[model samples]
Target: MAKIAGLAVGMSLALGAVATPAGAQTIADLQAQINALLAQLAALQGGSTTTTTACSFTRSLTMGASGADVTCLQQYLQGTGHFTFSGGATGYFGSITKSAVAAWQAANGVSPAVGYFGPVSQARYSAIAGTTGGTTTGGTTTGGITTPGVEGTITVTKNPSPASGVKLYEGDSMKTVLGIKLEAKTSDIKVERIRLDLDETGDTASQDSAFYNKAVQKIYIMDGSTVLASSDLNSSTVVEESNEISITLAGMSFIVPKNTIKVLTVAMDAKSSWDSTYNADSWTVGLATDGVRGVDGAGVNQYGPSAAGVFTNSFTTEDDILDSATLAISLNSSTPNTQQVICELGTDNDECDNLEVAKFDFKAEKDNITVTDFVLDIVRAGDTVATATTAYIYDGSTLVGSASVAGTTLALMTATFSDIDWVVPSNTTRTLSVRFDIDDAALAADTFVASTDADDTTAENSVGNTVTATG
Candidate 1:
């Protein structure tokens, strides 16, 4: 059809140009105008609209313009609750209509409206022009559609601070107080209540709110550090409906302000399907619920369609701290005491004789645990030293390792009976020092086979890693 129309215009111009040999130059001028008009018509046609819906305009409609397009714009704004036209549909783009258009543009992500209907407004209008209760839908007595008035937007977020969610590993999860958040903005609707339904599904080993063996999941509503209220899925108010183990949280109040937002917190977790294996396909937890709020002027509440939010756990399974893990050992940097041996001189042998003892330092493998005590085996020694005589652990300048000392076998290495109160955090290494007069004069190399932590749910034996002494 467009090609036919262009061909018709060209033929008409060609005939006119040939007839007027005297004004032959006028042919170029007419062609230019025709081409410009065709380009504009093409733009309007391409705005994702194919209907004869007379909701778009070619020129900008300002305060003085008057046409059917202006009337359509006025009606559209009124439908979106941005305009309140008093009299019958007048085709004039007057002050009242201009003000309404500016407000509509501002609300629809087009800020700082100039009160002029231009291309930007045209694009947005064409998008929502086909709503079920669009301009075509008629209402009794009120003279308009009531169902598709204004929409309320509600959203739940995982990391409200960063706006980007926290990295969750296999065992990693987020909760109301920790990361998950919720926010809602009411448009023309009078929001009397907000209902939130959270569910976990898929064969991904993810557990639902019911997995806790309790009624539902929990959430905390906070205003900064102060907790306003706490709600859960099992609440008598939130309707429980989703089949895949779900929880619901609904807030009821006298009145929720228009264009205002309210935010809260929720719970989200990585799928249980995740193990040591790196899972690039992490499961998603969904926040699903209808825009169940009060209708603007209607006496009843709970209207409109539902809105859903989903958060993808992008963290890989490799990041998971395994149920059982490895604890390793290393040699820390320390100064060597170079005193030569004078073993036979002293009678009060409170410590090793004049033999020069090398002060050796040791460390544990990286973990997210505070290791209070460990059983070490000096599998290999640089000088084949009998055992570690004096062991001390330090957190900066403060000594924190538990005390342990035994003179019996190679299995036990501490003298003076002391254990370092040490901790091995996740993905990070921690250091403790074992400085003693070995039965042998050589630096003692050692192996850590395992460790013990009563509080750690994720515990594994030590890697029994061998730390070879250089000296």
Candidate 2:
């Protein structure tokens, strides 16, 4: 059809050129226009002239992959004289397509020439197809249907701070594990699907099944805090072939306009409880180079970079620390304790009893916690540790426990009051007052500092699970 129209236009131009007056318009300029039109027509008819064909190849094609992209590859190869098969552009990559690809690769100086149309071959073809005249050293014009609108290109950059070496404890929900940035170059891009490549290390077949069944609760594609799409990783949404997992986002509507960047985050929710003994394993998440499926403003499918080793994020599963309930400890804000105290001189070096030093408040979440031990550290300024002889822990007016501050060193001493066995009910706070007994040998400005830190106190929940305090 294009050739017929070109022929009619050329005939009219020829007749008009002959009938024109000599001085009205230059005969040379008319002939030049006619010649240029003839050249373009010949290029369109797949002649010796080379012309750029508007076709975009977003995916690497090999044997067995069938799509419009493959058909485009075949048509371009046929025009380049590399594909000589009788059955032309069947839209399926068969043995003939392989042969044609190998020939094209060899002609274009692509190494090895094994007929695998990968990133290197795609890049080389793109370079040739993007040239002004669409002509290369050994190839003629590319023949294919001209795709309408601008040629869209998507660049996928791996996130700089991908979550790595993370411990995904039980009950961890909606944790972002992998991310990539997508930039649309020439047109708006509508991202419809994303493919995740799963790599499990030290995982058995049953463990893999367990992971898909219950370990991973849901996988989500997030834009900041908004969810674009989510899947439960069941058979309906996921297809597993070899080491790759393809997730289908059929109804997703994530769009990246031209000259803009959109961040795509992959997050997953872990089940609150899983069989740690059976399903614990390290897993790495990545995007398959051709897995990011989307369409540009022109409604052409776009893919992420086909380069290998671009994205990688690894995480391991571990047993949860808080099994029954959470135990939190913090410095009591309501306590009237002061760090610096002025000791009154009573002739014989000031002796102070029950000097308030530190106060701790412990809370149990959802379960009763019996605090079994409290570890205290006392530092005496400008005096020996013996100046602070004893440290007592009082629950209001009742002395729960006391320890002698004579262990460890002279200036700094550690006092462990064990077997206190103070029970704090669920959702209740337990405040313990820490007091020090200062001997009369201390100077006027001397001070006894008492403090405690997280993980220094131990407690057991109602279900008999031992837990360390956390703020």
Candidate 3:
């Protein structure tokens, strides 16, 4: 009878650990799992009095998390000499609570001191539960906790949110924000910084607007409607590996959530001159690095259009793109009415020598187009052959100095000019004056035929001297 009684006591003690039939792990594995198992065991013994430990926490806590779990976490931290919530643990996991959690994590030698109560932290908590400020401090504690900034493999696609690609002008004032849409596929990427790479010679003069400002020295980045980050971007911040401008958010971490559309508008600097190469051209905005301020560099691969999700917008021109270049000849200050002129020195060569024969002027009505070369079509008019008609052209802009050329015959004379160094300014006018002499020639009647204005645009119009009979 004594042996049987001892055996029964041993059996009861062995069955104590059998409270959880699904393995030997304590209730720390899962709250629901432990509860169901414990409840089933209790019913089997006809409502026998058997008490099991309850869960203190069952959910994860993060930066913006606020609930009973956070309250319990705060209490535990305070008890463990890791935190002193000045607000007295209000159950809100705000910045203060995050700091305290990070402090505790660092104290306990966690890999990253982020205030995320993840699986590793929860496992550690389970190992030290029920102690002074341990896991069982004030609430139910459990696992299945995931770390922040490590959500998963994030993908970014080029989807310029709110509108099309950015359009910026040269010498534009600062604070110009470009709404670049980014579609985060399966989010979880903690985009810390955005670096921009621009080609040095990228302006296209597409919009007839000059004064290009392309040297962006600083910029601010926005995540949705919130201004998440900003950084001073300049020559100093160029990444040596890629030679790009890196802009990092100040004082906060910007994480891309799952299945969300995040717009990263790059508000460039107004004080500094932006790089002209970025005008009407394409550039790159890459993801962050491991450090604070910018997006994680590894995340660049997760974005589409590859090449770090480069941005580009093509400018389209409407209507006929015509440039008006006018070169007109006049006698003195009179506007040109006739198309032809001949030196009226029939028998008086002295009159031709001292006469102010003609005047020429050239003007441009367009912007920034290089003229490879220009020509002036002239003809020594009439059946009479005269080659002594010498002309000199003087530039009013002091650009062409003075050029002298001999006369050409009537078979459609062409005066080709090379090395004509000049740039066409939009809506700006430039002029040249011409003086000619008959040079002691005694011809019956000769006319000097020439085109009035020949430019990069339109057909060559004629304005020349026609002398039927010399006066």
Measured against the true structure, the TM-scores of the candidates, in listed sequence, are 0.35, 0.49, 0.32
The lowest-lDDT stretch of 10 consecutive residues in candidate 2 is 134-143
lDDT of 1 by residue, 182-260 (tens): 3434432333333443433334444444323221234433434334334543435344444443333333332233454
Q: Candidate 3: which stretches are off by over 4 Å? A: 1-153, 161-178, 182-191, 201-214, 223-226, 242-258, 270-471
Worst 10 residues of 3 by lDDT: 462-471
For candidate 2, give the lDDT of residue 296.
56
lDDT for position 99 in model 3: 55
Better of 1 and 3 by TM-score: 1
- Number of the candidate with higher lDDT, 2 or 3: 2
User: Model 3: per-residue lDDT, tens digit, 151-269?
Assistant: 23444444444233344333333343445555444323444344443333334533211211234445566544455555555445444344333344444345444455555665554
**What is the lDDT for 313 in model 2?**
85
Best by TM-score: 2
Write one digit per residue (lDDT tens) for candidate 2, span 103-175: 5665555654546799998887765554322221112222222221234778887876555876667777778
Candidate 1, which ten residues in sequence have the lowest lDDT sum?
136-145
Alpha-carbon deviation at 469 in model 2, angstroms: 6.6
Error of 2 at 51 (Å): 37
Model 2's number of clashes is 0
Best by lDDT: 2
| lDDT (CA) per prediction | 0.42, 0.68, 0.43
